[model samples]
Target: MNMPLELCEARDPKGLYKLARAGKIKGFTGIDDPYEPPINCEIELKQDNGICPTPTLMAGKVVTYLEDKGFLEC
Candidate 1:
């Protein structure tokens, strides 16, 4: 008897559709969609700090600010 070395996994289409609808997973190419705000406040505040801030500097500033505000994990 001979067996195939590679097996193709089959996904349940209905389960996938349900998960997408419930927003459990992101579907890059989906039929129905929910609308999120154009800007998230935290990220927007971080980006708006400077137009040409170096990534390292920006990261440091964000870390410092979050630390001062008691938001940083460590």
Candidate 2:
């Protein structure tokens, strides 16, 4: 899953980002620590046109990829 930092921050359901921003949390992934996206990933789910696709759509994409690559037999 690859979402923008701002979107992730906005959707901070656990408020970890807030705590990380306030220095309460240390070594946070994106707040303090670096977040380097994978250079070569098999699949990447991201937002399109500033709108995130539903979970069903995202899972469909992954399933399709897997089937194409012969990872899923069914």
Candidate 3:
């Protein structure tokens, strides 16, 4: 990704969108690259509340998925 041409520009957490809007960065995934969301991913997590699941919590999700599939016992 190219440096923001406007040095004084404010940056979001991941400046990809901003840089893309300014046409500064090329070959940026989801901006210039072709991206297709997975239709049948095993695990999908949403972060709209900005609450990232801790590793322990994430492990529990995986364990639950596996248990539901009769892959293991608690």
Cα lDDT of model 1 overall? 0.48
Overall lDDT per candidate, in order of appearance: 0.48, 0.93, 0.61
By lDDT, the better pick of 1 and 3 is 3
Q: What local lDDT score does residue 39 receive in model 1, on the 0 to 100 scale?
A: 50
Q: Highest lDDT, which number?
A: 2
**Candidate 3 deviant stretches above 4 angstroms:** 1-35
lDDT of 1 at 64: 85
Give the poorly placed runs of model 2, Cα more than 4 Å off. none
How do the candidates rank by lDDT, highest first?
2, 3, 1
Off by over 4 Å in 1: 1-40, 43-51
**Candidate 2 structure quality by residue, lDDT tens digits, 1-74:** 89988988988899999999999999998899999899999899999998989889999999999999999998
In candidate 2, where is summed lDDT lowest over 10 consecutive residues? 3-12
TM-score of each candidate?
0.32, 0.81, 0.45
* Model 3 local distance difference test score: 0.61
Model 3 residue 56 lDDT score: 78
